[model samples]
Target: MNMVEHPGFVLWFTGLSGAGKTTIAVALEAQLRERGMRLERLDGDTVRQGLTRDLGFSKEDRDKNIERVTFVAKLLSRNNVAVLASFISPYIAHRDGVRAETTHFIEVFVDAPLEICAQRDVKGMYKKAFAGEIKNFTGVSDPYEPPINPEIHIHTDQETVDESVQRIVTWLEERQYIPAKVTA
Candidate 1:
């Protein structure tokens, strides 16, 4: 019997809120689907509401949250399912821990200026954070340790969503994460 190769992996996106992480992740997933790849997405907000419902926003809680997500991502990857995760993931140690779990891990940093992220805050999170209604908020009350050597960096403030998606797709193609296509 021919054994199927492990097809699952993770494209881990780290960024401050309102940095367009979710937007770009959804777009990337759609692009991958167009190429017939099976995938699943794990957004920070959605996971917090469910799997991480008991967790708080303290630094320790944030670390635990990422730990849980990393474990789940690894499990999914082992099953041959592509996993896309978008989270603030403020600490470099947390991200490094996640990276140690799988060879297919790709860290994509969605880099956007704090002002741009504040302006794009459709959820009013930045406003609340600035007003002190929220505390320990990343890029506001808390620090976000930017990735020093991300596999891909999307400067969302300077690029269109489609352009960002294309950049990620190009990287995946170049790295053989996804199969190369043929053209007549």
Candidate 2:
């Protein structure tokens, strides 16, 4: 079967912690890779360990983090690589900056209520934040500005991971960013 070649795009996932951004990105990445798409995943946790290791969670640091990631995403997406970035990215200005810098940018708001996110926190981050152990936590001490008009929005508390992935894939296909899957 012949494969469809498409231009590069950035699928940016943004939400508060434990809101299922990474989960959906991981599933969507698997699907895209299976379809033979060249892909890169720039996750917040992994990026912080390396690219933004020196940065704290201050507003300035958050901006710098997204700025660096945006630079990388811009280069890769323009070169026809699918860039999947999952970040808290709590500010609208930073996200808008990335959209302006990248090619075919698609913002995905993975939304879940603070209570739901806290319940889903396997890393105990929410617990610590509630206990005053963690400062500058989004949805807690820090502000997380929800996307005013994202390309896609998924409510993790309501939708299953598969449902969320399918929604994104369908959107991409509809927009011709990715061709519809061929079934045997």
Candidate 3:
């Protein structure tokens, strides 16, 4: 298939829950939008409520959820719409499966320690997981395989949101995934 007029790619944000994937994704989406990029932000929780509503936390269901997201991302990218996907895609195989389908894939690992994430959890998922209320919870009951070699790694614990956004913008410019904006 022919490429879109403007380059479009998958900016995949993968990490543990409360690892700042959504925070970074939201800011990045805004910046990209300001730059006039046609894009979509497909967050895990939002997708779960809709497309993956029937899917549970089982590995099989998780895989199916990711597969659905990947399919949507592929469709958008093929039309030159960038995708900012934030998911706790803990399985390497699942992440790799999505990667294999995208033409321009940038895997970003939003790194944060489990303890820190737990401390910052507004949804109380970590608290519930620790209390045995939630099963198959990534980092609590499920496995979260970090990307072996992610294109970008955001240490969310150490960096402020602005700093992280700047880092990603720098990376995007360096890679020419997005056009560099001219300052007035």
Better of 1 and 3 by lDDT: 3
Could you say which candidate leads in TM-score? 2
Screening candidate 3 with a backbone cut-off below 3 angstroms (N, C-alpha, C), the clashing residue pairs are: none
Candidate 3 or 1, higher TM-score: 3
For candidate 2, write residues 11-32 as lDDT tens digits: 9999999999898999999898
TM-score of every model versus the real structure:
0.93, 0.96, 0.95
lDDT for 139 in candidate 3 is 99
lDDT of each: 0.88, 0.93, 0.90
> Can you write out model 3's per-residue Cα lDDT over 118-177, one digit (the tens) per residue?
999868999899999999999999999999999999999999999999998998889888
lDDT by residue (tens digit), candidate 1, 1-184:
2222336779999999999889999998877776667688999999999999999999899989999998899888887888999998989999999999864889999999999999988699999999999989999999999999999999998999999998998888786777554332
Global Cα RMSD, each model: 2.8, 1.4, 3.1
- Report residue 44 deviation for candidate 1 (angstroms): 0.4
